[model samples]
Structure formats: C-alpha cells, structure tokens
Target: MMTIMRNTKLSTRTAAKEASHERIVCVAARAIRRSGYDGTGVADIMKEAGLTHGAFYAHFASREAMLAEAAGRACAEAAAAAADGVASVPPEQALTYMFHAYLSRENLEQVERGCPLAALASETARQTPEVRRVSTRYIKEMVDLVARQSPDWGQPGSHERALVSVATMVGTLLLARIADEPALSDSLRAAALQHLPVA
Candidate 1:
C-alpha cells in the first residue's frame, strides 16, 4: 500500500509539472512572435506564465531549447489555423480566402498574434540551427498547403506558383507592417491582393 501511494504521488507531481511546462511553452510561443527571439527574455516569459524564474530550468534544458520548442509550437498553430480557414471555404475559393485573410489589415496590425514567419523573418537567419530547422519545416508545410489550394495543384508550375504566392504574401505583410503611413500600408496590401491569383 505504501508503494502504491508513492506511485500515485509521483504521477500527480509529473502531471503538475507537465501542466506548468505547457503553460511556459504557450507563453514563450506568443512572446517570441510578439517580441523577436532576441527581444523575448526568459524572465519575462516566466513572469507572464505565472511561474517563478527559478522553475524554468526544471522544465527546459536551456533557453535555446525552450525557444526551439516555442518556435515549433507557434509554427504548428499558425499552419493549423491557416488549414482550418482553407477547409471552411469552398474548394474554388480557398486560395482567394487565404490571400485576403493573410493580407488583411487586421492581420497586419495584430503582429503579436499574426503569422510568425513574417513576425520573425528579420531575425530568423541569425537564430540557432534548431530554431531555424523548426522554421524551415513549417515553411515547407505552409508552401504545400498553399500549393494544394491551387486548382492546378499537381500540374506543372503549381509548386512554383505557390512558392511565389507565399513569398509575396509574407513580403507584403512585412512591407505593410514596416510602412508608418496607413495609406501606404493599405496600398501595399491592395497591390499584393490584386496580383495574387484569384479563383
């Protein structure tokens, strides 16, 4: 009976630790996106997660390890969200919907909660290989998602087209966000939307 009791206590402690770990990762994911990887700090993430600073090491081996996991989480969430949006519309309208939604002003202003690709693009090249690996994996998934949305998905040039589309969308969002003038931002988005292939 004593052994069983100890086992139960162990399980309970493990579960609680897992929950705290999840909370920290969740907070870190959003923080990395809202603030660049360099801008995000370990103490800030722990504080925001409502956990003590000292407890962070109990969950992750190092800051880069945590950042890698956070980057993966952020990418997965963004891909899932984009896939959900695509699934909600008719087959013929999926690409159009994606283009407009991605380039929308709301997405532009919501940098903290927006696409991590655009949010972190300026700093990604300098990130650790682990973080870059996570980013690269999701980038391919995103390109595939966009390509699959194309009517000529399996046909020649489809992948290329999707590549261009994703690149344009990301670039447009970056430029729009960089522009201080509201009119310039609006025009940049409008121009990108006009060029995007509409179904």
Candidate 2:
C-alpha cells in the first residue's frame, strides 16, 4: 500500500509539473507574439503566467528554451487555426480564404493571436540556432499545409506557388504592421490580397 501511494504521488507530481510547464509556454507564446522574441523577458512571462520568477528555472532550462517552445506552440496554433479556416471552404476557394483570413484586419490587429511567422520571422536569423530551427520547422509545415489547399496542389509547380503565397502573405503582414499610417497598412493588405495567387 505504501509503494502504491508513493507511485500515485509521483504520478501526481509529474502531472502537476507538466501543467506548470504548459502554463508557462502558453503565457510565453502570447508574450512573444505581442512583443517580439527579443522584447519578451522571463520576468514578464512569469508575471503574466502568475508564476514567481524563481519557479521559471524549475520548468525551463532558460529563456531561450522557453522562447523556442513558445514559438513552436504559437506557430502550431496559428497554422491549425489557418488550416481550420481553409478546411471550411471548398478546395478551389481554400487559398482565397487563407489569403483573406491571414490578411484580415482582425488578424493583423490581434497581435496576441497573430501569426508567429510574421512576428518573429525577420528576427529569427539573429536568434539562437534552436529557435531558428523551430521556426524553420513550423514554416515548412505551414507551407505544406497551404500547398495542400492550392488549386494546383499535386501539380509540379503548386509547392512553388504556395511558397510564394506564404512569403508574400508574411511580407504583407510585416509591412502592414510596420506602417505608421492606417491607410498605408490597408493599402498593403489590399494590394497583396488582389495580386497574390490566392486562387
């Protein structure tokens, strides 16, 4: 009975630790997107998560580790959200939905729930190799997911088109976010929406 109780205690401890880790990641993910990876700090994440600063090291190896995991989590969440938007529409219209959904004013304004690709992409090259690796992995996943929705999917050039579309979309979002004037931002989004190969 003592051994069984000890085992149960161990399981409970493990589960609690995992939950804490997940909470940290969830908080950090929003922090990273709202403020660039470099702008997000451990204290901010811990505080946002309602966790004490000292408890952070117990959950993650370091700030970079948290950022890497958070970036992966953020990217995966964004992609899944986009994929769901695509799935609701017909295949031929999937890319159109993706384009508008991604370029939507709501998406652009919702920094807390926006795309990690658009937020951290330019900064990835300067980040730790691990962070860059995680970003690359998710970007590839997004491109593949987008490719699947393209009208020419399975054709020789479909992937290339998807790559261009993803690149254009990210660039557009970046420019829109950086623009000082709302009109310029709207123009940037509108131009990309009209010119990009969404169909």
Best by lDDT: 1
Report clash pairs, candidate 2. Answer: none
- Global lDDT scores for all candidate models: 0.93, 0.89
Q: Please give, for residues 6-37, the per-residue lDDT of candidate 1 as tens digits.
A: 99999999999999999999998999989899
Q: Scored by Cα lDDT, where does model 1 land?
A: 0.93
lDDT of 2 by residue, 1-199 (tens): 9999999999999999899899999988898888888899999888888889999989888898899899888988998898789889888888888899999999999887889988877888899988889888888987898889877789999999888888999999999999999999999999999998866
The per-prediction CA RMSD against the true structure, in angstroms, equals 0.9, 1.2
- What's the TM-score of every candidate structure? 0.97, 0.95
- Residue 70 displacement in candidate 2 (angstroms): 0.8
- Report the error of model 1 at residue 8, Å: 1.6
Shift in Å, residue 27, candidate 2: 0.5
Q: What is the lDDT of residue 159 in candidate 1?
A: 93
Q: After superposition, which runs of candidate 2 have C-alpha atoms over 4 Å from their true positions? A: none
